[model samples]
Target: MKRERDHQFECGICGAEDRYLLHNVRHRTPSYRRLCTNCLLKDHRGLFCPFCFSVYEEPLPIDRSMCNKCPSISHKPCIPSNYPHHTPFICPSCSSPNFSFFNPTTNGDSPSGRIIDRDSARALVAAAKIAAVSMTKAAAMAKVEAEKRVKEATYAKKRAREALERLAYLAAKEKEIMEGKGGGSNYNGLYLAPPPPPPPQITGKVEK
Candidate 1:
């Protein structure tokens, strides 16, 4: 018996395995290749489809649109057919108030009014990631600074309390010294009379 080979697929762009097969229609002879969902969407050069959360290379006959306010792109097939139509579509990603289909304007303007190419979008995402990291670092630095300030403040308060206690102790000591001097004594610049001279020596115990 012959063993059958398992058909395994991998995406050429992202090196993902077991992906969907996509047919390239650009060539005169159509060729098929496997593409992961991520690669497929990335090729579309837009945000994920709001309805399917998938990416597409181009707006197909099925339906496709872009949000004017954000990078969100959508496919009509992913949404209910009865979805209420609005003049400008609201972006489900960023919820931008403006939106439109990915179709060229009557004046031959480019499709998807926004001029974000795949490379540009990648750059933007990279920049955003860097900005986020910077912001996080700044916040951490700020927190550290705040903590340092708090510690310094606490130390200062402790010093102030200690100084006040020392002043109080000195005041108490001075008061005690003053009270001690109240008694008649030659202490603290005060003088007191000596005891009366010894009684006249009993000179002669004279005539008993």
Candidate 2:
């Protein structure tokens, strides 16, 4: 949608381009701050109300009319009794010049007065489906990549733990070798300590 009124702004939360909202709309939030639809729905608030930004909560009736000038929709209690049901309807903001923020479609892609051809509508639907499929594929790829990274990290940690255990075993063996000095500590297929002194050196010659 295009803004006609003077001021320009963005959503307080998401920083997406936005406009000054109605008092009722602003009050939907606890802080009465303005936000876009996606930002509001993160809290699971409401549906897509263009004027209120639906932040989504503000309940809107299913019975509604699409505006003639823009893609905005207005439902009961929100719109006037004189709202055209049969003919094209211009949304309140588009109809009124004095509104705090007035936005109507600048591009004539779907002007209410013009009915879209069947082929054009079909093409638009096809494009939307393609986009949705592409998004799903991208999300799947991201999830797979994240899982792979986690697996790799776990493997590295396991290898590190094994190495630490080996070092600890070697450290213990070194102490044992120093104390025993014989027939005790072996490491990596090698006897680390010298043989015991030849049975106290039998200095007095062998017995007859």
Candidate number with greatest lDDT: 1
Candidates' TM-scores? 0.36, 0.34
RMSD of 1: 19.1
Question: What lDDT tens digits, residue by residue, belong to model 1 across residues 1-208?
Answer: 1211122355546554442233121111123333443344444335355555443334433556666655656776666676656557654434432432221224336553345545434433433333344356566666897999999999999999999999999878766765665534545655465466776665556675
Best candidate, TM-score: 1
Compared to the true structure, candidate 2 yields what TM-score?
0.34
Regions of model 1 farther than 4 Å from truth? 1-113, 183-208
Error of model 1, residue 118, in angstroms: 0.5
Model 2 C-alpha RMSD to native: 15.7
Q: What is the C-alpha RMSD of each candidate to the true structure, in Å?
A: 19.1, 15.7
